[model samples]
Target: MNLRTLILLLIMVAIAALAVLNWPLLATPTTMSLGLTTVQAPLGLIMLALTALMAAMFLAYVLGLHGSVLLEARRHAKEMTAQRELADKAEASRFTELRSFLDVQHSAMLARMDALEARMSNRLKESDNSTAAYVGQLEDQLQRQGGSGSGGVQELRIEPGLRP
Candidate 1:
């Protein structure tokens, strides 16, 4: 047993022994004042009975206090559990929202990349067409210059003495 319980037990044993040893004295009648009048009664027994009654009341009070403390602790535990669940749900919702936002951004980025590719392809085709036109014009000029001269190679007289 704990020290406090052992000590209380010892004290109770001592009180019981004392009461047993003084039985004759406790049984003997004596004059006692009862507020309005005096009466002959066993004073020792009366005092012992009053002490036992008070001890019983104190025990009941202690039991009630302990029970109330246990109930309060249980209530607090339930409230903490509920709060934790709410926080978890809120965190999950935020993750879902973030995921949707990222998906939308990814889709938009893909669309922009496709648009850029189309524009680049159109520009490349335009560049190729312009390059081909320039080459065709140069061929036509060469053909006209050759047709104006004899069918053989043309001779240019930059100076009568020096031909290049």
Candidate 2:
């Protein structure tokens, strides 16, 4: 047991031993004065009884205080549990909102990539068409100049398989 409890138990044992050892003296009647009257009683026994009553009262008070504290702690625990649940729900909502925002952003990014790809493809096609037109014009000029070969104009032939 704790030191304080052990000490209290020893003190109670000593008081009981003292009362038992002096039983005759404790039982001897003596006159005691009250505020309004006087009475002949065993003063030692009366004092012992009063001491026991006070001890019992103090013990009752201690037990009551301990019980009340336990109840308060239980209430606090319940409140803490509720608060924790609320915080968790709020966190989950934030996560859900974040997920939805990310989804929208991801979709927009994909759409932008697709549009850029389509524009790049259109530009490539236009460049190929322009290159073909230039090649065709060069061939036509070379064919017309070939009719006057006396001027020593060399024939220019572009390879069909080559691309700029």
Q: Roughly what TM-score does model 1 have, to 2 decimal places? A: 0.61
Stretch of 10 with least lDDT, candidate 2: 155-164
Model 1 Cα lDDT, one tens digit per residue, 103-158: 99999999999999999999888778676666666566668777787576654322
The best candidate by TM-score is 2
Task: For model 1, name the residue pairs that clash.
Answer: none
**Model 1: CA > 4 A from native:** 1-7, 112-164
Per-candidate Cα RMSD to the true structure, in Å, reads: 8.7, 4.7
Best by lDDT: 2
Q: Global lDDT of each model?
A: 0.84, 0.91
lDDT of 2 by residue, 23-97 (tens): 999999999999899999999999999999999999999999999999999999999999999999999999999
